[model samples]
Target: MSSVLFHSLRVKAIQPDTAEAVVVSFEVPQELREVFGFTQGQYLTLRKEIEGQDLRRSYSICAGVDDGELRVGVRKVKGGVFSNWINEHLQPGDTVNVMAPQGRFFVPIEAESKRHHVGIAGGSGITPILSIMKTVLAREPASRFTLIYGNRSLRSTMFKEEIEDLKDRYMTRLVLHHVFSDEHTDAPINMGLMDRGKIEAFLGTVVPAAGIDHAYICGPFQMNDEAEAALLAAGVPEEGVHVERFGIAQPAAGAGQVGAVVHEAKPGDAEQARITIIRDGLKREIQFYKDQPSILDCASAAGLEVPFSCTSGVCGTCRAKVMEGDVRMERNFALDRHEVAAGFVLTCQAHPMTERVVLSFDER
Candidate 1:
């Protein structure tokens, strides 16, 4: 995991992107430049206190690496405390606790490589995709990018002007397609949600799936699933497609079930289990009950500070390597199969299935 320590950074500017969204820029001090340096498509975990309650949220970086800016887009969701507060009350000069950027949602850009990349995003999901698109266009001169962005309407589209500017600047190398669900467009293809059929049509008409070097999908679960399926059906290799989900999906029945049948602990089952947590080269041993919410919750209850955000298991901030025990995850929307096979588990969703468990955050 990348550095998870929070740094006090002052908000340099706040520009409204939509009626319910704003783009915030932070002032990173020169001393912490190296610590805050982030790759494209990474995100920052912010911590704030409201009415004596602590809240943490992860926001994706929207600025390109070569742009020399550190900014994030915040869209107010219905009943979203952190997002609503940010859109309504956050102002320039206000300080925020921001963790260093962390994520694995990007492919390496090579200047001499002539690759065709596609980005499929929905609403605010464009944040990280914007970063990747801009970086690829700037860093790799021979690369071409096609963006298929979906939103409810133009009014709710964040970074609308910035995207238009990018299209104008990279007219020949960039292809832009805006799909609006609630707005009318002259082109038939620009209307309606991006579902499986629409994605398949796109692969067949607009961009050839065989010519695409990399495909990125970021949005709700259904959209991501549909787009990935279309890509795979079009003969794109599974390894060439990447996805990022904004929230965790409810686990299906019998999901994550291994060979053994694991059930909730009963009165006769072992109540307590020993847990070893390693972070920053330090080890902490703690005992937790089987009924404890999760390993993350238990670690926090023991007064051990472990980095985490979006405890719903959407963000991979709390991922750790399980060294010596078997564990079951309640839900997992962030980790890929390769990582899971390598013994990595999201501590926020993990529960001990063994008597003793040893986990490491420093193992990457």
Candidate 2:
């Protein structure tokens, strides 16, 4: 559970990053500064009520650690309720509910270490990468950073001017490359979608896998995987690569809501499973059908508002511990091997494998 507590923070400012995106800054009161302190690549979850509906969405913090500010880039997408509202209506001084920063997209910064870092980001995915690059450049003065960002066009590129400013500031240490999908570039190789072949070509030339101390990739699902695969094929070790799974909101088919599913049992496997969830010192039991997607779905079916965002198992907001019986996660990208071995599972992806399962969300 990634801290279910929400704090009311006042919006400090709003700057338009692009036509479809805005950079939002929040004012953290003096007393809550410590609570809002965050790492480079973490994110903040914002909750708001719109038209009688409570909506929650997560955005990566775009400010660097040493900058001592809290900000996030919200890019409007088709049918994105919160995003559209933020870009079109949000104003300075408005109060919004925000959760503490949470994510695992950054590597530890060592001031004395001289290393080469690579970052591949696309569209608004550059939010966290911007933080990482700024922190690295500011903290580890000896390290060099390389960024290959992709977008549809210059108009759609978030943080374009800021990234350029950083390049000018650290001309010798920062390398920046932009790839546009809809716009033509002087370099023919940088004018296409950043797929596996494009990323491999960059890996082979501009950003080689050899001597890379750390690599961070965040983009659309396919592009992220493509960049990771290209780096691996180019000999980048598994541990050296850190990927943040972006674009978790799969729009609901007919409704505007996201990730809403009908709970039903599998055709042949019709046994109902008993699931006991322990949250905030309260115990609740529910009957779950095995064919359902996850325990999180079971919680939702029972009208339990479990702490979950990006129910796709990318964020660890719905992580809990399995105390009794057994559960198998359908997929996991949040928890590490050690955490999984220690009984921690992303409840969003966990499916009860036993007839009776007891899980606790209070424990880390």
Candidate 3:
């Protein structure tokens, strides 16, 4: 039987910056490396016990994967149980259960390619973008990076000093522009929100769209959408724009929370659907509830182990393939249409529409 060990990991340090924001770093145990190896823009799902219930939250990795340490920046939202708990109670050496890194929000740089990469981010959305920026800057010799970061004020921006140091080190290759929405400053370019006009103006004046090969955007849903639109309007191709949404927007009209109904059944019964889970060389078949909208939920409820970060379809962590039968997805902000047509299904958003389904997570 497969198992997920709830290892007690020590929190090496926690640095609280703004009132509701913190930068947390942890030292991973040796055995956890197999689970924690991640690409640039992946995130970790931290499972913590709060108020006698298991609360899970996804936090994007801010540090480069090669750093050999795990770190994430979390911005606490009002009344958010997990975020508030991490900011208020989490401390150095504190133990918590965290799932392995799981996401496809990043692209690897080719060794011989020279590209101009840009990132548009705000608030805690800078986390994954930071990882992607740092990784690309380090991996590519002729690559250049430019960041257009937005925040309410200077005090609210996370990793201010680190970003500045990066700018100084990269010198001509790395550029950063800060936009403060609340405070008016002496700098003429610093006074407005990153609306469509401002984003276009910034791109026109700073990094020309023609020179940029890739654009990564992460922020509020509207911000991401606007940034992509602005980029596309400025002659950037639609394929060059990659978006990572922080959270799901409000469900559209008539859309409800997706769930399932569990029922007891025999192992080989035809009515009992089969879910194939493959991770790290192990493969197993598990039963599921037919009426549910997500196999991820059913697997979690049945005590089957799977690698997942966000339960929502926003993060691609729970992505797997349907090799045999058909499945329908609820909402997908992570995968594009081509990926969906290629049999990729976000398990967190997948429900078997057919009687038999075979899926795989082991495909590279």
Give the top-scoring candidate (TM-score). Answer: 1
**Of models 1 and 3, which has the larger TM-score?**
1
lDDT (tens digit, per residue) of candidate 1 on 1-364:
2345889999999999999899999999999999889888999999999668799999999999988889999999776889999999999999999988889999988989999999999989999999999999999999999999999999899899999999999999999999999999998788999899878888999888999999999987789999999999999998889998886443567686221223355443336779999999888899978878788989998888898988877889999999988887877888999999999999988888778889999887
Model 1, position 53, has a per-residue lDDT of 76
> How do all models score by TM-score?
0.93, 0.89, 0.87
TM-score-wise, the better of 2 and 3 is: 2
How many backbone collisions does model 1 have? 0
Q: Which ranges in model 1 have alpha carbons more than 4 Å from their true place?
A: 1-4, 249-271
RMSD of each: 4.2, 3.3, 4.4
Residue 294 displacement in candidate 1 (angstroms): 0.8
* lDDT (Cα atoms) of all candidates against the true structure: 0.89, 0.87, 0.81
Off by over 4 Å in 3: 5-7, 31-35, 187-189, 250-290
How many clashes in each candidate? 0, 0, 2
lDDT of 2 by residue, 322-358 (tens): 9998787766767777789999999888877778889
* lDDT-best of 1 and 2: 1
Model 3 earns a TM-score of 0.87
Ten-residue region with minimum lDDT total, candidate 3: 258-267
